[model samples]
Target: MSRFTTACIVGGLAAASAFASTPAQAGYYILRWDNTGICQVWSEAFTFKPIRWPSGYKIVSRPVPTFNEAVNLQVRLRRQGRCTL
Candidate 1:
């Protein structure tokens, strides 16, 4: 094979790999503490895991795409008297 052919193959592979590898999720979750009934917007992408998280909190909403959206939902929940201080 010629040097030019090898370079083309290498470049193509690099581009393919770059496209195939996706970044981590940027979703957010809304959590409400059982003890306090206070809601919060969790920024971590992962869902509720008892082993990973402390007790007394439960996931109230599905994963939201942005932090602002999550906070809006939280505020709505509070207005409905679901999340109290």
Candidate 2:
């Protein structure tokens, strides 16, 4: 291959490898009890399967908001009589 072509291929491979090696940003969520609207817990990371949350609890996906916002929302929801432990 030409020198320029070889350089381009190598650079492209390097960039691809770098991107592939980087880890994806994880999402956070809250699990609030359906009956009480007071008992709430934060998940360690996002998941599809049922987490270890107690029975009658619902998952609140908070993937876009900041961590503080997620926590605050959970507290606010509980205070507003939305859900409980």
Measured by lDDT, the strongest candidate is: 1
**Candidate 1, 1-85: lDDT as tens digits:** 9999999999999999998897766888888888778888887755545442455788999988888899899999999998994
Query: Total backbone clashes of model 2?
Result: 9
Model 1: pairs clashing at backbone N, Cα or C within 3 Å:
none
TM-scores vs. true structure, each candidate: 0.61, 0.47
Cα lDDT of model 2 by residue, 5-72, tens digit: 99999999999999999976655567666555554545455456554555566676455445776777
Q: Which stretches of candidate 1 lie over 4 Å from their true place?
A: 1-24, 46-55
- Model 1 is weakest, by summed lDDT over 10 consecutive residues, at 46-55
Best by TM-score: 1
RMSD each, Å? 4.0, 5.1
Model 1 steric clash total: 0
lDDT of 1 at 42: 84
Full-model lDDT for every candidate = 0.83, 0.66
